[model samples]
Target: MKKFNYQELVDSEQALQKRSIFWDPAIYEEELKQIFNRCWLFLGHESQLPQPGDFIRTYMGEDDVIVVRGKDKVIRAFLNACTHRGNKVCQAEGGNTRSFTCSYHGWSFNTEGELAGVPLEKEIYDNLPRERFGLVPVARLDSYKGLLFGCFSESAPSLIDYLGDIAWYIDVVTDSAQGGLEVVGAPYKTEIPGNWKLPVENAIGDGYHVAWAHAGAMSVVGAIGNGRSDNVLGINANNTGVDQSGAIEIVMNTHTVLTTLDGQSGYALYDHPEPVLAHLERNRPNVIEKLGELRGRQLYGSETHIGVFPNVQIIQGLNFIRIIHPKGPGKFEVWTYAMCERGMPDATKEIIHDHVRQTFGPAGLLEGDDGDFVEAITHSAAGYATRQMQGFLGMGMGRKAPWDGPGEASPGLVNEACQRGFYNQWRRTMEADNAYGVIGQTAPVTPVTAVLKEFRHG
Candidate 1:
């Protein structure tokens, strides 16, 4: 068990994170206690368990948990451990079950986590106290736009507050369709030999990799134009009709953005793009009136991606939310849910699902490229002395300021502001005594109900 100076390992904003944090057993234990045990970890989606008796087994750090829809149709979460002897009660990943029976001793618990039956209880000790032996429930459970989360710390703030400004961005993509979103299928789980934070940092807006790391995939997809030659586009490219607004228009009122491929704002290269365009052409005036010109162009067209911090990552055009769960320091489990509007045509849904499978899933062409980089960085940190050096995140560091952008405050895709914001929030949460401190901070909080209420309502 390699011990680490947590403060020194994390606070060196100028340098690389200490390599020990990835492979050190002692640091992993502390993270299990400080980070995983205290933060609002994404479990699954409400769509996964739409009816009573529906349950899914998940993990917070390494602890097994069961998120279930109770008989009342409300969602609840509990530790998967049996109270009698501390053995894991549920072994399967997810399913519909009326009661969970422990294989070791035949102890059974209902959806509400009440101990329903205990084998040989009367003979064992004149009836052991069943009331005192139910599965231990998690401290807090909540949802945002159908996404579920759980926290072990009793003092943690509401999930809404914890998400802060990121919620606004989430609503844009989530609320694009009329009836909201639904996940297509179970997640595709895999393990990457890397530090958990590396992926999070990457996904939290490491757009710089889109060109070089995924050059082959991008070229194949024809998403890049003249920008293909340079790994990163300079300010010159920003003005050549590829600025954020020209490339993607943010609907400030709605929080969704109108995305275009290489600044081409039309429906040309889509699979069924012709039919969808004809439909839009038939209803152009009304569609334009409702969605506005830019957003209307985005409707049934173009690839738009967004993230709901900590866990959910959605590409609207791709129609999937990749739920990331950190297994330990150097391992992670990714669950991707294919999202689509309820009542979407079967064909449309099928197309969306296939697109997600091709682009982002475990065997996805795009994900394959990024996964290698994530693993290489993790392994490189294995050198004790080399890991002590720094990795530069100062790209566009001092340039970012508060702004009304389509997304959160950022210096676009080329900057590290988003990664910095994620780690900043992460450090705050891990260092706080209780969850309230993490959610209660007085900074540039986002405009979600939880954050607004925490600072203004409270």
Candidate 2:
């Protein structure tokens, strides 16, 4: 937990992170304390629990929690553990329930998390105080456009502030349409023997991996990864026969956006692009009028791969929201949910869900295409000498963000700008004493220091 360990673990000037960060148990424990506990970790979308008594079990860094809709119509979360003997109060992933009863002792808690009933109460105790035994609540719970996030630290800033200017980009998908986004079907869950940060970095717009790693899926999916936004990352667009002219790649702090500018829609890989394209075209004018021409017209159907710092990610067009849950230093769970505009036809929703499953689910086509290295890098670090080496994120260094978004925006998806931003925030979080030291201290984040926060000149 020493400051020097963090400094060495992530040396930005060298544009590298120690291989050990993906393997060490001790460093993982520190991350739970410094990063997971304080940040506003996404829990579940409100659409998942609509009725009173509806609940779903999810996790916040390894801490299991129950997110329920109260009879009073408010959403809240509490530790899944019963206050009695620490046994889980509920086991079902989700369902409508009058109350959660501990399977072992029969202690029960109501939706608001009050200790509503205790079996054999009169005989078991001499006036035991029921209120003292309620399910322990998460420190802070809040929502942003129906997405739920919970924080264990009381001093953390409001959810909107934590999102920063990233909200504007998020609005392209969430707020642009008449009705905001919602999870369409039950989330697809799978466990990967990979470090949590690996996936986080990948989704932080690792557009570089899309071409080589997912080559098999490329041809079938219209080669969307063939550098369509701005000419194959550096390779000429003409070489691939995919015209990249007029398409714009918008880089935001910790995110990468690709707009198939001038009426071109983004989800090229879907089975029937006509349905998706029609939907986008139908809504184009309305969104443009609401969110402005630049954000609405360009991004409404654009391919937006956004990683909301730490671990939540959203793919706007193919449309799935991902929550990367940390199981341990070398293992994590991928919870994938399809996101679609609430106003869309049920058939369109079905299309988005099917495509999300085929592309990003556990046994997905592209999953195999890109997962080998993710598994390899983590397990490789078990070797002592191997773990000592540092990994670099130096691609696209020294590039200034000509456009205003947030954080430093490097030019293309091939750039490791988001990865560097990921580690810089990780470094600042590990080095800070509390939540206030990192997020919300500033608005829209004053761009990183003159030389990238971690990429120091001296």
Candidate 3:
């Protein structure tokens, strides 16, 4: 069912992709089989369900899933459908419940995904086989920090190995605050008229779009003296972009990181930033003590954007996380979460939640700008002539990053090297024969010590 050359869909060397990928149903089907089925997919944060019997309904490549905390306090996930007659189960988005009862027939399942009861087992069914009727379970479940993920393949690499070098960059944010990060409120959700891949590509490393696409949002943000520029948000005293002398774009086998060695704007866009700044200042010594000045100062509060393969994105400075879920070939849903330090003051948490909605939430100014553009780009591919056209992501092509970080680095934040890395990873998964082929393609993890080079961008 392939309509074009698979090799040309994403050419690593040329840093280009065919426009058909955005509009083709056949390609989207292949993505479901190869990418979503094989890789670990983000579920929700552990903080969302702290006690036994708690559960949330989510998706794993269009497959409805129920992620629950068992009586043993272990997190588990299973297909969100009753075994008998294959009826839908657990319709509520999320809540604390001892068991899920199917609407069609009163079939119930325990938090451990075991069959609990049936409407008429003794009279109607006459000794029905209960052991074989438990919910189908996800093969692998793991956590990185507080984030939960479920993978369908048993043979896929461990979550740590899967994250590769990008893990080190994330450590800067997670390790700095002893209390760790948490999801502040329910995610702001909206549907976008675009390919699922579009926003993932945008969030991961499109530093080039900050100044141009987000001109309106940035203008307002800058007016109050917090001029955010560069890959992540950074304050510029002169109202110029963050200095790039120390910035680096690190592209690994299957992940990308855009770091501008001077991050510091975790909550800069908030109207009252005094408390946030004061909080960060109070933690400065501990951050320096634990991570050292290099990581503590540059990557901690500094703005950094991380793009994990397949479909997860983490953008600090804006201080939020989002997942691009594919609805089909023509549309996808964006689920945005406001993230914050766990031990933060209640007032600060309030600020973080509202700030997230104001900037990157579904109706957020910055996100609104991106939604229209990606939609325009995806819809244009529907035209036969346009679908046959090609696109380029060749900015800063062939340039190596000038840093001692984990992966090979590109020179600046505006470079498209990170975007190229994503496409290349996408191509590898789409071309693979099975889950192992995609999971085994990563390079050996670079030792964290070796990644920390004592070089400044300037």
Q: Report the lDDT tens digits of candidate 3 across residue range 149-185.
A: 8888665678887887888887776777558888754
TM-score of predicted model 2? 0.89
lDDT of 1 by residue, 1-458 (tens): 22445466666366235555666666767667666776788887788898899999888877889999999898999999999888888998888999999999999999999999987777887757778988898878998888788988655667777766556546544554545568755788878877777776676456566666776665554224323332222222223322333233221211223234331223221334334344335544554465455445433344444544455566655566776677766778777777766655666566667666777778776788877877777777677776776566666565533444344344345566556555555555556554565654544444576554433411
The residue-level lDDT of candidate 1 at 72 comes to 88
Off by over 4 Å in 2: 1-4, 223-265, 440-458
lDDT of each: 0.63, 0.76, 0.79
- lDDT of candidate 2 over 1-458, digit per residue (tens): 56447778888786799999899998899888878887888898888888999999999999999999999989999999989999999999999998999999899999999999989999979999998999999878998888899987666667777777777877887786557778854788888888999988887657667666776666455334443343333323233433434443444433344444444445765656667778888988888888888777656787766667678887777688888999998899989888888888888878877788888888777776655788889999999999998888888788654554444455655667778778877887777655666662533333456225223311
Model 1: CA > 4 A from native = 1-7, 11-20, 222-309, 405-408, 440-458
Model 3: weakest 10-residue lDDT segment is 449-458
Arrange candidates, best TM-score first: 3, 2, 1
Tell me, by lDDT, which candidate is best: 3
Where does candidate 2 clash, by residue pair? none
Clashing residue pair totals per candidate (backbone < 3 A): 6, 0, 10
- TM-scores of the candidates in the order shown: 0.80, 0.89, 0.90
